[model samples]
Target chain A: MILAATPGTATLLVELGVILVGLALLGRVAARFGLPSIPLYLVAGLVVGEGGVVELVTARTFIESGAQIGVILLLLLLGLEYTGEELTDALRDHAPAGGVDLALNFTPGLLLGLVLGWDVRAALLLGGITYISSSGIIAKLLADLGNTGNRETPVVLAILVAEDLFMALYLPLMAGLLIGGDALDIGLEVTAAIVAVVTALGLAVRYGDRISQVVFVRSDENLILSLLGLALLVAGIAEHLQASAAVGAFLVGIALNGPAEHAARTVLSPLRDLFAAMFFAFFGLQINPTDLPPVLAIAVALALVTAATKLATGWWSARQVGIDPPGRLRAGATLIARGEFSIVIAGIAVAEGIEDDIGPLAAAYVLILAVGGPLIARAVEPLTRRFSQLGRPARPRRTPTARGTTVS
Target chain B: MTEINETKLPGVGTLHDFESQSGGRIGVIAHHADRREVVIYDSADPDRVSEGVTLTAEEARTLADLLGGTSVTKRLDDLRQEISGLAIDWLPISSNSPYVGKTIGETELRTRTGVSVVALVRGDQPLPAPGPDDELRAGDTAVVVGTAEGIDAATELLTARAR
Candidate 1:
């Protein structure tokens, strides 16, 4: 009998299985070394990428599109977890110092991009992309380090919330500019976004309790389906309005925040996690190995500068706001990790042809940040302790509580 | 005398005792006196009580009453006592108020409001671990803890001075 060729479906199944197994093994190894598993996952993607021995993911467009969805869902979860009060608190806490941090990180990236002969739009995109610290990696590392309940967790979360809010506002504006759309069109888009958000909030306020009681209380399956449906519908509407689908998804998540919805998140989380993994894997597939060495060098350099600037800016801000030395150091170290959203911005830039060459660079930067950011965060405790000893007498230790614990 | 003698049982408080002893029990007792108890006894044949041992009219009536009524007044009273200590009062800072963006120490809030800012519920986040320098933002709901007068003063100041 003639040997049957491996069908695309079978090949995909085999590749996915191998990639997942490799990722799990690598993640375990990384955990043993006290590093976050995200870096391992990224490395695994690199191994199975086109440049590596195996070619598991060959379609860059499909992978990128899937990754984009992952980022949208990630942002939606973030919005769901935070409310207007929480968001405002984050802004207040970070506004005084985050402004400086943003400037320091953005300025260097902009200068570098310009020096490299990049266009204005490209330079700004690069700058903005580099300016953000990976909140996801940092938060994960903090939890891993058993600092999730630390007093500084909320502060770091607040800072991240501020950064994300800025990103949500900035992304659409950037898209409008690069699309060469008219001012009136952009204005109308912005107004429509505002109206959509208000309507979503109004629906949430009016019907949230009843909806939660029916959907979540009745059965978890219903809750998951309803939430997923809401996310997709909102994203679809956002696309229709020519705004970022991620922004719409985020607004829906924000509107859903309450005790009843919070309970339902646990059931829905596994699905989000699955999609999120696929998203990161897709991002990994987009890297062209031949372009990596030079891009990696730039990524490392930019990551270093961004981390330093973020730390210094965060520290100074915390100090200005009268945070203790330990608290400031913790905040500084924690704010250094950057992840999916940065890549999304880079991908957007590529899609719009604003600076096609910068996508790989931005992706490389995210990879570097994901790898190195956790290491810096892990060192914060020892560093803070050392600095606290050198400084004035340490402040009286507060008893640990749930509401404002510091994450590593 | 019979009622008094029948009121005591291990793990059975005044509420349960009253319900057991009366068809419909209703009464109050000192909080501390209602604490849980444990009973221990040695019996050659513990199950013999159900084998038709003769009992006086008083004993039969007490047992019958104990099986009749249903009352969980003790638990309800405990819940009430716990809730009484959790009074929360909100303070508003009016638009023309002088306390905008000021810290607790800067505003001398303790002196002016006569209430301790136990927590700050700003939007969706609650600052249960608020520091002395945590600046007050507009529309912050300060969870003040104090007497009625203190709560009123804090509320008035918040209303008068909040941005």
Candidate 2:
């Protein structure tokens, strides 16, 4: 009767229902296709977004908020997977090689940005995107290969840790730069953010177990609510403080310990997955399909150069540890993927109204490597192995286990 | 057991990890005398926990049964042999177990195996020192105390097909 006269909640509900159902079906298809569902989700976003098939007039606002949650949860889950203690120790141990890694892998993007005649900030953003590798894809490759006992894994891990540690330090700095303050203001903001993060980290390291004891309760509902609520609260505060909500959520995740950590992860993973999908879609939604064709050539060429540089970074780092040539090759191949962090950097930059080209370029570059990374990693083993065999028989090395890196 | 690393958490417990056949680390927290928690690390990120499963002493036995393969598992018997003298073990009664729907007294578990039911665990709740008059439900864990021989007998009796 009056449904036609006024905009009702039913329209929003129906749209959301349709979108969610579509996402589920796409997720299943992606699983079957052995893709990460990220690409599929991105495509879905592009199709549903502006200048595409269907424009959702009602659900756009809902999606925008969901995307923010997605980014926060993505970083939070990642942080929960890694702890503060891990980061500090990794940074301390791998500083020199990590330095080499930064110099080599990061140079391509910076040089490319300069060549393309972008401003310093955008160039830096581009460089940041190029420097970081995708831990998510590499991790999956490691698991799929079931070659966990390989000699090169620890070396690869050291490099990954170094990258992760760098991101933790670099993200707050980037966020401050995005705020467009003068030198002193930027420095002060960055310092405050770093100090806050470090203090929070120190507290987590010292009082994590005790915090867990307090957070856990007899009821599952209370446990999840408290953990999610705390993460959101930290993220909000971090955003207000200009520390980046991702960092805040991540810190909250790393801070949780013991029984609460396990329970919280179990409860929060579904929500994280949901939001993470939305985040990817939102990223895709921002990119105009028309802009993609022009960026395609640069994206492919940049991916190739970065892929080579990443290989060089891995080769040099693993070589520093005296790994065999084949192991070095494997290490190089494994580090090729660039997924979450690159997109995140671009997202933050775009949010600050940086060059529009940055987003489409990043989205294109990530799409290339996230798909190609796995294929290359899979092929590298046999490729390197057979090549090594052609030269001479090699003995399996019994290397000492990596120190301070007990997976447990 | 070779210790990969040890951390002493003052009020909580001592955490010990071991290097598995794979490069990943597995850890156990020996908490409050008898309680233990098993931890598995994320292979890709050694700093974070991939999984942490906290099982009570009662639930752990049910886990033992599951990991033991089938009910009449050779490994479970070998596990009992490790505990000399008076031994305690948890035996699971599946949905279709012969002893289901009968009182502990009627099942004559003690009569057959010379083992006493120390407790009965149903889900998270453990009924300590379960009386013989208590009914044995499906998916119940019978916590029996006995010698290795008695446990083997109980294991056989619990898993046998219905009469």
Candidate 3:
């Protein structure tokens, strides 16, 4: 065998290997620093991207397709874990607050985008993308801060779920507009999605165990293959219907949610992790450093404004719901991270070849969110505690118990 | 004074009364005194000390005397060990079942199923282990922990469809 065959293939392999290893190590480092690993992985991608050491993943259609798969899988898993009852409860409890938060963040983002001389559609897309709260990062931070057991976790989780649902609808709506798709086409796609979801739910109820036993109980390898096939099949169907593939994957996840599904997850987790890592890495690779400097300043300002708006919105709504000040702060802080959806909107604008000038600015905004999301989340607990103390009257403290006693 | 072989029954305990003593490995007497005589023990291999002849209390005491007082202690230990390793099985709720969309507390699952809900999985996420307030969704999978009888009850309740 030839030691090194094709130069193009060799270079691609080396770059891919190096980027993955570097990102993995950097991810560990980020965790050690008490930061979310997503940003670090993104940073690793940037380092190995065009302007950095080696460019492995080019800004090509195929790479975008792969990244899309990653997003679909991520959302699909999200859907799988979601129960309609819990989600409905969450929406009912937080809808007013969520709506208010949406308005507060989106209005300012829209005005800013307009002022910046961006296209109307671009402005709206940007507004929607920026207005979203980072549920993943916030949830992770809450767990890290040992406040997952707090009363606020559920409320905040609900809010995030509501926000995600909003984004799920909004992202496609924006994409449809940008891609020149008609309202009737969009409606048909949405209807198809609903029908597919309902069908999956019906099937799950009727034959979940038999299907799981037959598909997953055979062998570990077979289980992995079946789950992957299912994810891909659902995603493909969604794409064919002109609906977001992520939505289909999520529906599949929802359908499969149960005891047998748990077994399936454990086996599929490694595959999901690997693909997710690639997804983020691809995001990092797409950032063009030459266009970043001017965009960075504007992006940072927009991110701060969005974060502050969300914090205020989350806090006020939470307070209205009778949540304690500290809990509200925690919720507000956790809502700061944003990811793929925002970038996807920006990517659509770029792909349509309209408002190409703002593409760099949108990328910069994503980068800032990537960095700032974790910082805000990390600070939420300490900040909440400080604020809580300030609001409280001085009183004699009870001696603490080792196992932890509930506060009255 | 009596000499006992302590090495034969390692770490065995002595009984204060002779009636309570076990001649060999002590076993749970499963049947009535008049029926087929059998004892349940942890050991795969049990030693026999008697022939076809009926055993008197004195004869039993004499057999115990030969085996040493340690046999009784060893038998108790073995019985405890066997009971501890008993397995519990759990089944998932079928989608069309009435148990779906109900809370564990509302179901009176503990009383009916004899099995306690230890954990639940809905999709990819497991519920923060499970608690009373956590409602059971249609697709949720519950991990029930209990004895065989308890598990049997739980399975029946979980798999039962809406009336």
Each prediction's RMSD over C-alphas, in Å, is 20.7, 13.6, 20.6
Task: Please identify model 3 stretches exceeding 4 Å from their true place.
Answer: A1-5, A51-53, A57-65, A181-218, A351-353, A398-408, B1-163
2 against 3, candidate with superior TM-score:
2
Error of 3 at A325 (Å): 1.6
- Arrange candidates, best lDDT first: 2, 1, 3
Candidate 1: where are CA atoms >4 Å away? A1-6, A57-66, A148-152, A182-217, A392-408, B1-163
> Residue-pair clashes per candidate, as listed?
22, 0, 6
| Per-candidate TM-score against the hidden true structure | 0.64, 0.69, 0.64
Expressed as tens digits, the lDDT of each residue in A295-378 for candidate 1 is 777778888888898888767766775667677777788788877777667767766766656867876787778777777877
Candidate 3: tens digits of C-alpha lDDT, residues A192-307 = 55565556655654565565566556577777778878889977876676565766676566556455466666776666666677777666666665767877788888888888
Q: Per-residue lDDT of A283-377 in model 2, one digit per residue for the tens?
A: 77777777888999999999999998888888887777676677788888888888878888888877777787888888889889887877787
Which candidate leads the pack in lDDT?
Answer: 2
Count: clashes, candidate 3: 6
Displacement of residue A110 (Cα, Å) in model 3 is 3.2
Please name the candidate that would achieve the greatest DockQ relative to the true structure: 2
lDDT of each: 0.63, 0.76, 0.62
